[model samples]
Target chain A: METPLIRLVNVHKRFGNKTVLRGISLDIMEGKTTAIIGKSGEGKSVLLKHIIGLMQPNGGEILYREKPIKEMSREETRVFRNKMSYMFQGCALFDSLNIFENIALPLKEGTQLSPSEIKKMVGERLRQLDLEGTENQYPSQISGGMMKRVAMARALVTNPELVLFDEPTTGLDPIRKNAVHSMIASYQKELGFTALVVSHEIPDIFHIAQNIIMLDEGQIVFSGSSEEIQTCETPVVRQFLRGEAGSMFID
Target chain B: MTMHESPTQGSGILHSLGAIVLYRIQLAGHFTLFLAAGFYHIFSWPIQIRKILQQVYFIGAKSLLVIFLTALFTGMVLGLQGYYSLVSFGSEAFLGSAVALTLIRELGPVLTAIMVAARAGSAMTAEIGILRISEQVDALKTMNIHPVRYLFSPRLAAAIISIPLLASVFNVVGIIGGYLTGSKLLGVNPGVYFLRVESSILLSDVTGGLLKSLVFSIVVATVCCYQGYFTHRRKNSFGSKSVGLSTTSAVVQSSVLILITDYILTSILL
Candidate 1:
């Protein structure tokens, strides 16, 4: 069997009395787009956070390339983190920085790239995200959609090997949502980087994601390819798909 | 769990008291860890010279006028009071030394520290708290940048280097203010007053005052930065209200800690 790039072996997490994740064991294959879909408060974002190392699991271990994350030395941790990028749900751009500076920050802080090279790379990302002419404007001056794009631009400027996107199209309009999905598909294809996206755009997200994982109340109810999910026999998965279909044309 | 319940009442009270004590211990432990984190990143790679300079400008250079005014008024009042009290004993000539010694040995460092804590310290807390609430700090971590290195370390370095220098400025301006009042205005001999002032001050006094200021700067910076950095953990508040609470707690705790540290340091040094 081929080695999976990222593996979770019975991971668990709880906050106070609330258990957010319960014994989550999953594999994320390399160079593939895996979309995790679930209802609200079903631990989709929490799972993404654990993968990104923002929060620690109360139990079990997370492995990247078959090496546990906690065992990595400081240098190894930095190298490990450098391979991945996370697009936050809230588009957490620095309010103090202009658009260009926000996108250029990861490179400036993490890489040995010369100033001109950083500027060139950031400019390319801005152009790709269609965020031109807003380089000098701060995040406050931009709209929510523009801020989302700027955040995506920031996450991609580092040219990471793995990108974890948390709700990249959460609040966008249908046109922008499809556009963003298309962007991710094109970028993943062109860059050959693994993309792990957590979103609920239903059929739109499923179109771009090759594999899908559905979580119902902290456990993976179904995990399979996009084509396979349509034929999934699990009750919750079937109900979820039915519900998704019900809302397809209603709103 | 109600207080009037018979069997559980005593256990409940004990539990509540134990929880409070444990909470205090946890707070102390967390603050210690925050301090360690702040100091550990002080020598991190790619020295952040620009950010330190910006903080220096905010903490030191911008505080000059306020320090001068506060010190001048303090010294003038001391000189005036000293002259009046000494005239009856035929010791009016000691007015300069009185003003100079008080300002240099005690008032200068304490006032400068309090002023900086009120101004730059509050701003630091508010900014970091806002960053914590907004997830900008988490974003920094995701990008492999340590938030302490990017934020707290620069402010720490700046406050350490700036507050002592500002205290010295305070001492100079205060002595000058005393001279204007005691010698020029209160009719003490200019030569005698300055000679007494020069004679009374020792090297130990200046160094001791600088040391006190250094300690105050560390406490203030650590408290303010720690409070702001942990704003997300606050139980009773969230969002901008938590930011406001953090800022208020930073300033209040810094002020109280500065005075307490002053007394402790003074007793030890004395």
Candidate 2:
């Protein structure tokens, strides 16, 4: 299938005794938006982490562009990392650095860009994210939504081929959530980069995601187009789509 | 199972002791590996000179006033006490030797390290622990940055380079404090006071103190950084309470290790 941009083959991960991801296999297409939807604490984040080689799976393999991540040489891994970025849930901006420096850090460290060039690129990204005048402020001084947008700015500053979002709209209000959704949608359309987002925000994320993967109890119960997800009849898929706490004492 | 039906108190105590020993061994191994990695990264390519300078400012330049004040008061007190004790034996001329020796040999390095452990060391732990909790360290890894090299090697290099310098400053100020009290306030002959200090202080004493300060700096930086780096691996929730606990543990562990290492170095050097 056009040699998926990223693929996970029966990935398994466990922390001590608790298995967070159990044999999850999936493929993410190039230049498409895929949303992984699951209940809280159901391994959505863990699955995302495996894709970027952040956390190695206990078993199975993760492949990027048909190459196993585990077998990449040091130089190859570095190139792989530079080509992708993961936007943390909390923004994870360096507290000691201002927003401008934070966004400029990857470009400064990874590329041979000069100071003026780095500044210009950071300024452009900030403006694109509607964070124009907040360059001089620290992460602590910004609101939650603004912090997320700034983080997105930082993530896209390098113009990566892939971006992983970990719960991009967890604690925001509806307005902020929609803002984030629209921002991601617009950026993906313009940039045409593959986006893999892990979230439990149903219809909001579904609006932007071309494909939906539902994870439950460390397993991918369903993976299909957004329209198929809406009509899927599997019990867990139906319950998750409807946002219902299924009957507890059902026979 | 009722409390009374649980294992005997003796077994529980043994288990607790065993756990403590195991935990300490694990910590020691972790610290050794961390230090080895730090040393390795020191020689690796892409040395970040700017970060090292910033850390030097944080760990050294910013600590000047407190170190100065501490050295001054300690030396003054030593001079006052030494003069009084020597006067009873009609050997008050030895007061300068006593103050200079005490300041240069022991108090300078030990007290400076203690102060730094409380100040910069704790701050480093807290900062890194917060970074771990907020996943900034993880973000660094994803960006192909070695967290140890980017976050810690600079601090280690800065501490090693700054502690000796700070200790030297402490020694100088302390000697001045001692001179002010012994020769001026105590009515001693200034010539004898200065002469005794010159004759009594040996190269070994100064070098020994510098050596101790160097060792203490490594201990403090390594222990504090190890604590912070592992804070995220803790089983508890990654929150403010965990960070606070890690900070306290880093300071206490590093401070205690400093004193212990000081004693060992003294026993060996002296």
> Which residue pairs show collisions in model 2?
none
Q: Which structure among the candidates has the greatest DockQ? A: 1
Q: Candidate 1 at residue A228, lDDT?
A: 93
Docking class of 1: high
Find the 10 residues in a row with the least total lDDT in model 1 chain B: B1-10
lDDT of 2 by residue, A1-251 (tens): 49999999999999999999989999999999999998888998888778777788999999989999989998998899889999998888999899998999888877889999999999999889889889899988999988899889988999999999999988899999998999899999999899999987887788899999999889999999999999899999988778788873372
**Two-chain DockQ for model 2:** 0.73
Model 1 CA deviation exceeding 4 Å by range: A244-251, B1-18
Q: Identify the leading candidate in terms of lDDT.
A: 1
Q: Cα lDDT for residue A235, model 1?
A: 72
Reference-based TM-score, model 2: 0.93
Error of 2 at B246 (Å): 1.7
Off by over 4 Å in 2: A248-251, B1-20, B235-238
Cα deviation of B97, candidate 2, in Å = 1.5
Candidates' lDDT values, in order? 0.91, 0.89
